[model samples]
Target: MKFLIVEDEESLRKSIAQYLAAAGNICDWASNYDQAYQKISIYSYDCILLDLTLPDGDGILLLKYLKKLNKNDGVLVISARNSLNQKIEGLSLGADDYLIKPFHLSELYARIMAIVRRRNYNGNNVVKYNELEIDTSNKEVKVNERLVYLTKKEFDLLLYFVSNKNKVISKSAAVEHIWGDDADMADSLDFIYTHIKNVRKKLTEAGCKEYFHSVYGVGYKFTDR
Candidate 1:
């Protein structure tokens, strides 16, 4: 999954990014409110790690903006403040979960996954679409009871397609979803096409029906029909 870390503390931010990346997630970091605002305005994420306080502006404003825009990006507020009212406010403002600072990174990962599962997969860790079964917890995919090997990127792409089945997802969005902020530096979107092709080949070889359709001059869509 893709995540945005809205944190000012350089060490903690880097730590969170490294941890999530190691877990096969794409991460983007923003040190202050303005940077956070810009990222949220442009890109979407599976979840966002928001710190309640910032040097320039309050983090609550960002929450309000997301609510105003009606974006479904899950939010997990990570703040040092332990006040009851602050937690209440953050939750009331649409934060999926809240974590007090000085907490374990493992706990943070667990919470983020819980939120994403709840919001996206309706609280199910294992996502099933027809004959395709994805055990997200174990990062395993099976088609018709046959294990299908996929690279991390290929697995992520397949999961993404399943999450938004039937929607025409542009190559740029796929690139951003997989590479996070690094997508901007990419010279072209040829890698996106390559990953999708590999995923299709693997699934088809595993006896799965073709669900991916390339839309000329646009992008691709995953649909049963």
Candidate 2:
């Protein structure tokens, strides 16, 4: 999963990113509203951990912006404010969930998984496409009941592909999704091709039908048909 942590506190932001990364997920962060705005404008995430307060602007406005752009990115508002009106307003603005500050990282992760599952898999933990069965909760993939082991990156790539099946995913988008926005500093995006190739090879070897199709001059597509 890919997530953006829009937080101001350096310690809390790093803590969230580290916890999510340890669970095999990609995470990017912004210390203020402007930085967060820039990232959201350029890249989309499976979930956005939003902080209501920022140095430059109110985080609530960001929610309004996402609504204006009609982006369906799941948002979880994490704030110290416990007011009922604030929670109500955040949800009304399109946040999928809300968590109070100083909460357990485990609980935060669970909420993120729940929101992603609801948004991408229609609230299901298991994803099925032809002979492929992915247990998102367990991070397991199976081809016709035979387990297919995958590295964390490989698993994330497969999930991203399946989530947006049949869409043309540009190399830049794939890089941002799999490696986070920090990958923009990398020398090249050629590494993306190698990862995709490896994923295809592994799935095919596991008896799963080929579902990945490379789009010339664009990127790749995963389709059941």
> Against the true structure, whose TM-score is highest?
1
Model 1 has an lDDT value of 0.94
Per-candidate TM-scores read 0.97, 0.96
Error of 2 at 82 (Å): 1.4
**lDDT for each residue of candidate 2 in 144-213, tens digit (9 for 90 to 100):** 9999999988999999999989899998888888888678798999999999999999999999888999
TM value for model 1: 0.97
Give stretches of model 2 more than 4 Å off.
none
lDDT of 1 by residue, 1-225 (tens): 999999999999999999999998999989999999999999999999999899999999999999998998999999999999999999999999889999999999999999999988989988999999998889999999899999988888999989999999999988898888888999999888888889999999999999999989989999998
Error of 1 at 29 (Å): 0.3
